[model samples]
Target: MRHGKTFGLSLFLLAAGTGGALAQATVVTPLQQQYITAYVAQNPVPAATYGSEFDPTVGAVVPETVVLNQFAVRQEENRNWDGGQDAVRSMLYFVTPTQQTVLVEPGTRRVVYVMR
Candidate 1:
């Protein structure tokens, strides 16, 4: 009985965590929506390469070939991409149709850097 309870609890926690992540992906603030809209307008994905589904894993329409396993938000550090040492806030990492990585600062919704 104790082992069963433990297993059930573990299952509950796992479900909750998955729900939370999915919720975060589907729901966005008004500001975030605006950012997404503007970004999409400026950088449209060609229909031939990507699907219409909005994939939060990469903060953009996912490529037909790639399956997004995870989406991460983290502070920036000095690296080859941006070269900024000060780690202040979090940013969104978007994967392009060409399999390139584009880092966007959520606040400004700016494509700060790219890794090809």
Candidate 2:
């Protein structure tokens, strides 16, 4: 009998095409657990971003209002959503040494106290 690679190939393709859904990678550690905790405490969502780590001895103190302002500014820059539904909470950020500022929305995931 002649060997038939064609039939095997078709069967493989059909099985692969309609066989199963792709599996997702499992996360062993908790995901954004701290941020969730902070959100409940903060109440109003703040525009939060991950920034470069700063030295604690630098004598830089981040205020609450400033964070909110950053949130507002960033939202404006990104043109975040129109209103309702996709609407996101405003937020802000101020880096003292660089004297740079950024604004963004916290979206649905708000953080209370962003800390180490």
**Which model scores highest in lDDT?**
1
lDDT of 2 by residue, 7-114 (tens): 223223333433222101111112222322333344444333434553212123333444444323234533633222111122222333333222222331122222
The C-alpha stretches of model 1 lying farther than 4 A from their native spots are 1-89
Give the deviation of candidate 2 from the true structure as CA RMSD.
19.7
Candidate 2 weakest ten by summed lDDT: 20-29
RMSD list, candidates in order: 14.1, 19.7
Model 2 Cα shift for residue 66 (angstroms): 6.8
**Per-residue lDDT value at 63 in model 2:** 38
Q: Can you list the residue pairs that collide in candidate 1?
A: none
Give the per-residue lDDT of model 1 (tens digit) for 42-113: 555442234556443422333435432212223431232232112112444455665554544443343333
